[model samples]
Target: MSITPRAAEPVDIDKYGPYGRPPSKPPAEARKQTRPGPAFPNRIGTSEYPAEPGRYHLYAGHPCPFSQRVMIVRALKGLEEVLSVSILDPMRDSRGWALREGEGHGLDEVNGFAFLSEAYRASGFEGHYSTPVFWDRTANRIASNDFQHLDTDVATAFDAWATREIDLYPENLRGEIDELNEFLYEKVHNGPYKCGFAPTQEFYDTEVRSLFAALDELDARLADRRYLFGDRITLSDIRLWVTLVRFDAVYVTHFKANLRRIADYPNLWPYARDLYQIDAFRDTTNFDHIKRHYFGTHTWINPSRIVPVGPDLDWEAPHGRETK
Candidate 1:
């Protein structure tokens, strides 16, 4: 059932890097953490320009962990009115990120191009084709292709225009959040990739070890807190959720990060379920999209390219954390 472009190859990582525009909003106005504590490095890349409603359009694929970061922020900040977003077709066939003419793929609602890669070039972004791209229509150029900091932009920069005040990176948690964020990113977030895309066995072994070490540690950490911090969720949760939700569905099976399923971890399971129950994160998750893209696309892993169908997950079951 493996169905991505790399289904025939074991692990065909054609290219690596965050594929998207540079950054649409500039440094000062775009990324300000509402949380009143220590300042975090600008994770989201910034552009040379300013924030303008409707001037920039976001492009993302729900299957992508990085893209989900931005989507979660957009929902939390209530920037649906101030900014626009386009969910691209998950299935891409070389032409890349295009609608199947009618197979649920819509004509480019923003730039009117059939392929997203083309749209990137159309916007003068010749670098990469990764997701969570911010397109600046006015300049006819990519504002910021960096996917990491898109959340920072939506959360703080748009506060003036947004209908609600949802501060994800609150000041009080900044100090602690900073330390945990580093841990999550290095060992958990990008660890699987290091395992999957490593060129040698030694590389894979190192990455897999680091990856699971972080997970085992995180499982222990979650035994006390409902979220990454106290009772409330923040950007820290959003970052880790992107990887955990995809772990059992994609990494466990494909990347071979099979030490333990997110389901196997007691606290982590409930934490993921709690987050999955949220509309913004839930609606953005597509196990099929993630599965097909990884197993099928990374031909280097499963050259046979047969997608599996056995991990029946019931994310809907109530997690008892709410009562705690």
Candidate 2:
């Protein structure tokens, strides 16, 4: 028996064009490509996975800031070859995401998935289609979607396969990285998400307060140091960098996370500029994809799904972080 391919329908949900109520459906059920993976459980003792040249694959959607964190860490660690990557379309429908047209994704490059949701199904999950999935391909299933762990896997676990040994997570700076990453996530990473996807005004209000409060603290902190780690870039710096890059692009107008723009923040401006100067950050960033994904796909947020233009920034100019 053959399962006939369903004919593609015009993308009619909404593309964030402007405000319009979505057509009747049940009380809003957040459509996920797959279930969100569980957090890395704390074990009695942990040992780093033995670093190998070719043992893992990183499955990601490029527009995902969480996924970008994993991508940046892999590059900074010089493990591009050690861990192969496959890109899924940032724009997905109810059926879940597939490779963008002519994007030439290897079918389930790790687990041979035609669609990303299959991995979640394979993992026996019934959650959301999340990004930055770490798969142990030889085992033929997802090792984890623990993005924070993704960095640890690349930097600490696969140190043997690392080409340059950049060590984004240095021993002396581990304390600062651990502390700031938590604060940053509360304020910025999931903060914007909570604001945008929030079901009620009260929730959005509280999240908005936390989001800006953290931004103010980060701006003050970065005013003294070159990077968050006091000069050199670290995993923590990279994590914040991905969010800052997207703040103006979609967070401000759409996510309603807009207390202020990155341009308006004093220290944040220079801090972002320094990260933007990095080869990996710039190369991975695409304003088009960033804008299109959130604005175009999340119909509940932006009813019309029309893309907006005009928050142009100056990321390339001289950022005086060195003098700070």
lDDT of each: 0.69, 0.71
Off by over 4 Å in 1: 1-47, 93-95, 101-105
Candidate 2 regions exceeding 4 Å error are 1-49, 102-111
What lDDT does candidate 2 reach at residue 297?
A: 80
What's the C-alpha lDDT at position 273 in model 2?
84
Top TM-score hit: 2
| Residue lDDT tens for model 1, 141-172 | 66765665677667766677777676788888
How many residue pairs clash per model?
31, 15
For residues 230-320, write the lDDT of model 2, one tens digit per residue: 8687888888888899998889899898889988988998889888888888877777778887888877776687899968788899998
TM-score of each: 0.81, 0.84
